[model samples]
Target chain A: MNKKYYRWLILILALLVLTFGAGIISLLSGEMDIPWHTLPDILVQKEGIQYSIVTQIRWPRIVLAFSVGGALSLTGAILQGIYRNPLVEPYTLGISGGAALGIALVVVLGLHLSMGSYMLPLAGFIGSIVTIFLVYTLSFRRGGININRMLLIGVMISFVASSMMMFLMAITSSENLHGIVFWMMGSLDEPNALLIDIMLYASLAGLFISYLFARPLNALRLGEEKARHLGIHSTITLRILFVVASLLTGICVAVTGIIGFVGLIIPHIVRLVIGSDYRILLISSFLGGSFFLIVSDIIARTVIAPNELPIGVITGLAGGLIFIVVLTRANVQSKIS
Target chain B: MAVYLNIQQLVCGYNLGFQLKGIDLKIEKGAFAGIIGPNGSGKSTLFKAISGDLNIQSGLIEMNNKKLSSFSLREKALKMAVVSQFNEVLDVTVEDYVLMGRMPYRRNFQFFETKEDLIIARKYMRLTNVYQYKDHLMTELSGGEQQLAAIARALTQEPELLLLDEPTAHLDISHQVQILNLIQHLNEEMGLTVLIIIHDLNMAGEYCNHLVMMNDGNIHQHGNPHEVLTYQNIETVYNTVVIVRENPVSGKPVVFPVSEKTFKKTTNTSS
Candidate 1:
């Protein structure tokens, strides 16, 4: 194989090994001290409380972290490509704000699960879809979408959604306010099997679809007009990416609340290491995101031990540090180059 | 040679009320053409219309006797390529940027670049002298090197027709000549028709066989470079006095704008 192919293979293999290592570490370090030796037996035998904790509660939580991380990073990479801006991420266009509003309203009305667990995700998905459509329509000029206009309008809408969510919070009973507030801050600690199931299929399908469009995404880096001259249908590609990214982001947010920075920081970190060809960036982002979030979740659990901190806070600190480092390194590299 | 691109009564502009009116032009196959005009003369606007990035109010553009609108975006791209006036410094490598030019020919779902694709990319990179910087980030290159990489990417399309908008606007003198020379070489050796918009009159006069000069959204002059690059034509269209001379080397028309200070000093001395 050529040097390029060799680099890709080595990077991927390294990520897989790190992800497995992180996964095992996550499985071992929870509140219940399940020894590393018991892991294989616990995984195989489904009976007893040890098996119950390992299989039912802990495994689902770990998978949720991985799936949610993977989904957010994939959408983040797609958003950055479509907008042709490094600062853009899944929520940069207000997908998370819409989902948060949807969940807040659901909580205020006590309509989270009168019917089933799917209702919450459905609500969040609808809110996200509506927000995307609104931003798209408003940004549509005579013939095409204006990305800057969409970005500004998205920020405006996010402000509106946040106020509405605050209003909903003001009217809610004090008893329910704590749960609502904590959820809004983001957490992967919820052991909801149904939410995990929802994220599994949607995130997988989103990754597959994103992989297929990687070629167009790469073309778009040259700017929209040039991408058009290179056979990419820019408007159609943008529209599809908008919908898919919003959906992935919406579902992930609905399940785990508004997890910040994983979407933004993972893709940038991956790009810094591997460069910005979306084909490699997309796959490596998923792997990197999974690893990063699993590690973050581990820190969230162990740093405070028995009490458990929100995964969002841990990611916020870690992501911020890494982002600062990347920016500084980029500054130095540009000066030298 | 047969007429390859024909634009007739091409009325188009960004705003509805402001438009290029009754513009008609034709370029023969394998011809090197240049469009030169003052700012806001609708030179770039005309390019947008021909490339199908802008909707024409009323008129038609034909390529190879087929209506330009008849081709799908992909079909249009397969037949023609454009190097737009892009200025952003992205983080992509030079090799990847060049490889993107093969997008029109690739199946989108196929993730891996074919062996043929790599060969084509490397060939164009070497041609543009950007192969040495293949692994460097795009922003790492100088403005001139980046411009060459952009041209190399456009050439990877292997198009029959190429449209460029002020491609050499940012390059230094030597790199400007190098890029224009490479473009001329492509046109002459490969039989590729080229339409370029240029701000430098001398370069336009030197490189183009035919020139189209615009003023107030109208084609003021369109003919051989020697006819269009005259002193009277430049003064009339540009509202500025210029001395037009012949270059002794290639015998092409050369233009020099008379600065206001020089004009005042000469008038004062004569009086």
Candidate 2:
């Protein structure tokens, strides 16, 4: 590979290594330290000293960290491609607010769907999809959907949804309020495998769908008129984008409230490394996002020690720092575009 | 040459108002035709109507032997390619951007261009003398290079009818001559029925087989360059007196803009 290619590869690989390394650190050193050698025995065997401290609790959280990391980054990458706006976040379609409203209302209502385990994420998923469909139909017309109108309508829907959440929060019992508040803060340690599984599956499904759209998304980078003139139906492409991205945002948001900026920053960082080609950008963004989120999750766990910090705070902080580094690092005005 | 397109009682305009009034014209197949006029004379407007970019307000258009609407967009694209104004798209490679012309023909489910498509794209890119820059970022190229790539893109479509809007709009002298000569070669070798909207009267005189003069959206005259581009036609249509002479090398009609003193002196004495 040439210098440019090598640089990006090195950075992406380094990020991946950091992600895995951080997860390992989080797994081994959290609260109770299980010796590194005994960790394997806990994972593989039924007869060995049961290191439940390492395997039972930490391992699942580690997997959740990796999966959620990948999911958040992929959602951001796909959103950037469809919107053709580098600054666009995962919630451009109002899925986060919609899901937030659903989850918040459910929490405030004292619904113990965690008993079923699938019900909470399902509610969030359904809410996001419904809102996405509503936004798309409102913006779509005889042929194509207008991006500005879609964004505006989504934000409008988000505002209304936020108000509804607040209104529901106003009347909820003080006891349930604590859980709802923590959930809204966004967390990685849901301690519920079924909910995490649903999100993991949804994220994987969304990623697969995004890969299928790689070629069309590249054409769309030239803007919709050119994309349409090139024989790809702009309307249909936008619809698929809406639904797949909605599924991703819905599932992620349902599981972990609202984690901002991962979607906006990850794709741009990938694009800077891998030019504007959607094929490369999409994959790299997925990797980078997964790595970024994993690393952030580790920091969230370690920085507060016994006290847990919201996953969103870590992401927002990392995203802010990455954005500044990306902007200032290169002669970006020329190389960036 | 037989008539390739016949437009009758056509009115073309946007929602603001009618730009092109009622018009009637016929373009012969394999003709290198140029429509020349001053700005706001509806030259581009007329072409848009003919190309179906703007809906014909009131008219019947017959292309080849069928009504205009009978042919689908694919069929029309196969017959015609439009090289619009020299717009810039510097993000893509020169080759892929050209391959987009084949979009009107190919399937759209994210398949890369077939080998045949690649060969065609390469061939046209080479023909336009932009093959060396096939992998180059479009933004890195000069203005002339971009225009040439756009022409290559239009050619890659392999259309029978080539409609260009001021293909050499802002190019320097060498680039202008290069585009005109390249277009002339395409017309001669491929028998491509070329219709270009150009403002350069001298370039049109030398390159076009037939010259069409438009004034206020209606054809003022149309014939072989020698017959139609007369001093009287120039004076009446452009409201300017001009001397028309044959070029010594090409033996084509060339116009020389006349000063007002000469026009006034001649009109006063001769009238």
Candidate 3:
């Protein structure tokens, strides 16, 4: 038992170190190569073109990457636990599609021009909230929320939302279409300090609240009925977890458009390495996701030098490849052992 | 003896139809009782009602003079633990799975299992003979071992009453005997109240001091094994011909199904 605890400690520490390394790389490698040693001085002095670039541009993006990535992965872990299926992620519930449809509608109607730039994320949030409410209410039965029913409803809603989004995209002008497509592809280049702060705090709070239910989540792995037998109010626990995860995913999608694979891939990788004990899985997936996105953001920034790729593109490519490799390797190792 | 569980006029079922009709039963404290019936006889429904899985439409279920409905899920868990017939095959290790029994005792904001919880879990693991498999994954264990692990987890709950639903259903004879013997030992040595649902009438008759026979959601008979396992009640409830005889070793009532040939020959001779 002590050894198992020690292993968790070491794995968490290793993930922390790796995340820190990724953050440093993200800071140093973007656009103009900022020297590693000058980082501390630039932070304290707070005055130069380098300082402006580091503080005004790169720092917020890094924090955004961390929170958005962590929040998505954390949401994925919670959703997977509730559904008891490894494939269930934030997107499976259609939150991303809802957000995308919201953004597309805002762009098509020229709401961002009339209302303000913030209208985009506001519409996105509103869209996701509506989707969540629909899914939650539609699937609720006389006794409680049937999980399988909810999954099916979520998938159906996602299809409808995506179809609506495509309809809007087809009718809109080329300029509006371009805006909608870019937002759908996703990026971390937000200039709003307030949004960044909200994302960071919300992600951390999501982690903290999710940690409180870690034991229940662990009990849930034995299946919902068994969890209730073990004294967990499965219905209440699942409802609260669903809200928490959906809100987190909603916030993430609103801010970043739709960063796809972090939510699906990070938790999968973390579970493989650290085991599925939610006590460790939650925190580990959060850190692993932050690390993955920070590294992916660096590649997005530097791979083309002057021309930057959408952060989502890098994440999808890197995350998908990594997941395939890890799964195949795990399959092989399990067969051998 | 004081009654541990009392059910009066219990009527409960799913939305399609009522599975358990008006049923009345009482089990004294520390008694090893078994409920036996054929499929769709409401044995499982009754068990679910008592375990708080199914809400009774109209009736009362009391445990130790307190209304079972009044107790919270956590409170019910504290008083009784159930080893369900089918548990999901999970990726968790045996030790971690067994430690989940301590969940009801976990205080709010408690992140990890307490030292005392670990000790209790270990004690039960040892008792159930799953100590050696503690580090092994639950999926790696045999059916009997998994059932033992489940029982160990239930034991770790330190519940006053232990309920099992056909625990030996899928096990081979040796494993069946092993599980029943352990249950009997727990009942005798620790004074635990056991209420089990068993398909095998002979095993129920041999192991249980008290037996309740059910037919169509109502109690067909309830008495000592000798009285409850009579040929008349067995044939009427199960719709089969069975001969009841006293076992030579334990002297408990044993049931043997009459073969078609023997039944025909006996009928012909009698006619």
In order of listing, the candidates' clash counts read 0, 3, 0
Query: Residues A1-337, candidate 1, lDDT per residue (tens digit)?
Result: 5577778888889988998899888888878888899888877876898888777777788898889999999899999888877788889888878887887788788887575676666777777877877787888766678888888998888888888888988989886677678877788866667778889888989999988788888888778877888888888888888889988988888788888898899988888787788878888898888899999998998887788898889889999998888778756466222
Cα lDDT tens digits, model 3, A2-55, are: 678899999899989998888887877877998899999988998999999887
TM-score of each: 0.95, 0.81, 0.97
Sort candidate 1 into its docking category.
medium
Of models 1 and 2, which has the larger TM-score? Answer: 1
Model 3 chain A weakest lDDT span, ten residues long: A328-337
Per-residue lDDT of model 2, residues B1-271, tens digit only: 7889888888878778657888888888898999987777789888887776667878888889788878776577778778777554646678867877776676646455677888899999989999999888787789899999989988988988899899898889899999999999999999999999988888999999888889877888888888778889888888887899999999999999989988799899998
Candidate 3 residues lying further than 4 Å off, grouped into runs, are A330-337, B269-271
Among all windows of 10 consecutive residues in model 1 chain A, the one with the lowest summed lDDT is: A328-337
Candidate 1: residue A36 Cα off by (Å): 1.5
Candidate 1 vs candidate 2, DockQ winner? 1
- Candidate 3 achieves a global lDDT of 0.91
Which candidate wins on DockQ? 1
Q: Which stretches of candidate 2 lie over 4 Å from their true place?
A: A1-29, A32-40, A46-72, A104-123, A142-145, A163-181, B1-29, B37-79, B86-88, B99-119, B211-221, B226-248, B251-271
**What does candidate 2's lDDT look like per residue over A181-208, in tens digits?**
7767787777787776777777777777
lDDT: which is higher, 1 or 2? Answer: 1
Error of 2 at B195 (Å): 3.1
Which portions of model 1 show Cα errors greater than 4 Å?
Answer: A112-122, A330-337, B264-271
Ranking of predictions according to lDDT: 3, 1, 2
Q: For candidate 3, write residues B1-271 as lDDT tens digits.
A: 8999999999998979757889999999999999999999999999999998888999999999999989988998999999989877877789999999999999998877888998999999998899999998887899999999999999999999999999998999998998999999999999999999999999999999999998998999999999999999999998999999999999999999999899999999999
